[model samples]
Target: SSAITKSTKIVLNLESLGSLPADEAGPLARYASTIQAQRHDYNGKVLSIRTEDLKSLAIIYDMSPDELTTRLIEWGVLSPGADGSIYTDED
Candidate 1:
């Protein structure tokens, strides 16, 4: 049931991406770029990151981690870790 629910939610979110304006796209693009860089740094693997690590990542991307995390969670780029931290599931 949870899997189905998650899948449906993802579908809806994906649909929303199609209507985003160019101005709103900038932050999303930047977050995506950072995600890609992190993935590459881990050799195409997903790196488990703590909140502090995420803050540093935000700095690396010239954005605030709080804002970046908000966007990433909305975009499904990062998920909540077991410890309630955020991490990517790229690998």
Candidate 2:
């Protein structure tokens, strides 16, 4: 017998809880609660998403890459590097 697993990384922000629609928000709220109990400083920690998912997720969310980037940046999950590159605090 064999087991297979599939998973992907996703970035989140403080506003994520409120911004997400109800269906999506529920799971995220649960995950946040789990983390909050495990780490006192979890609220300040940065969760970096894989760069590869950016464009794909943007499309899935019906947004252009630029729009997604802007939203992420505004949410404080993504940052613009001094060298004109995009990065996350965890990066």
Top TM-score prediction, candidate number: 2
Q: How close is candidate 2 to the true structure, as a TM-score?
A: 0.46
TM-score of 1: 0.36
9-43 per-residue lDDT for model 2 (tens digits): 34556454456665644544555555566665464
Per-residue lDDT tens digits for candidate 1, residues 36-78, read 5766752322333344555565676577756656665666655
For all candidates in order, the CA lDDT equals 0.46, 0.53
**RMSD after Cα superposition, model 2:** 9.3
Task: Give every collision pair in model 2.
Answer: none
Q: Once model 2 is optimally superposed onto the true structure by TM-score, how far is the C-alpha of residue 41 displaced, in angstroms?
A: 15
Q: What is the TM-score of each candidate against the true structure?
A: 0.36, 0.46
Error of 1 at 72 (Å): 1.0
| True-vs-predicted CA distance for residue 1, candidate 1, Å | 33
On lDDT, the leading prediction is: 2
